[model samples]
Target: MIVATVQGNEKGGKHITVKDGVKIFGKEQQEYINNIYDKFHINRIEIIGDFGIKKIKSKEWFCYMKHPEVDASGRTGIAFIVWDKNTEDDTIEKTIREIGFRDEDYIKFNKEYNKIKKGKSNKKKQLIFLVGLGMGLAAGLIVITLSMIKK
Candidate 1:
């Protein structure tokens, strides 16, 4: 089974269980996964991509897992959160709930979500267009210079 290491309280972790006998991570590997998990479990590590990771003794290194992928729907509300530095998979998927990232719809949802999150409505998005414009201008200038040189 492909199971990722995660803190005890963490929610979204990459895990896949097998039917009979399938060990993606063996004893030593599982131990390693557990070690990191234990650290995070005791709150000894930092988040996935959070800043100030250097300051902490154990910066939460996620081979996947690390973050808390929890479905608190049974308790009442469907709350799923995955945190990182400036990145997080936070979308209250109440109506349609699916397990694992292997799902096609989940992938599509994430793609759309990211697109919406990084849409042109935000200031950060303008950088992409600006960079494209700069590249075009530079290329045009280079072509003009080349043509003049040819003459």
Candidate 2:
């Protein structure tokens, strides 16, 4: 029997390229990474959900990280954080400590989260959606009217 690969694990062969190492792409975030890889020759990419970041490690090159968002409450909040790791920089654990992802620590995730939900953001989107929907409905009605007239 064949075994199913587990996600986010080394044994899991779920990746775009897996020749020497690994590369995973999500959304339009690949270009920036490609440039870095071409220059640095990155080795692996691992997503630390607990830390809310994609950690890219390279033995020959510099390591870099990209965080999607910090989980603040019942849902995942939005705060795109990018860390350009350097030898002189503090350790990842220490850098994470500067962040407030955990409840016990500073968890500065809330600051960006609060800034996000200022207005009724979905209102404009919903209005545009409804307008498109109404236009579609009117088009259908006109088509039906024309068919009836033709008959």
Go through the candidates in order and give each one's C-alpha lDDT: 0.38, 0.36
How would you encode candidate 1's per-residue C-alpha lDDT over 35-119 as one tens digit per residue? 5456455654444431122111322222222122444332211112222333334322221132233355445545655564456
RMSD after Cα superposition, model 1: 11.3
Candidate 1 displacement at residue 113 in angstroms: 11
TM-scores, all candidates, are 0.26, 0.25
| Highest lDDT model number | 1
- Tens digits of per-residue lDDT for model 2, 1-151: 0000112212332222211112335642355335544543343444344323233343222222232232333233222233333422223334333332244322343333223323334666788999999999999999999999999
Q: Whose TM-score is greatest here?
A: 1
Task: Provide the global lDDT of candidate 2 against the true structure.
Answer: 0.36
User: Between which residue pairs do clashes occur in model 2?
Assistant: 100-107, 100-108
Q: Candidate 2 regions off by >4 Å?
A: 1-119
Q: Report the alpha-carbon TM-score of model 1 versus the true structure.
A: 0.26
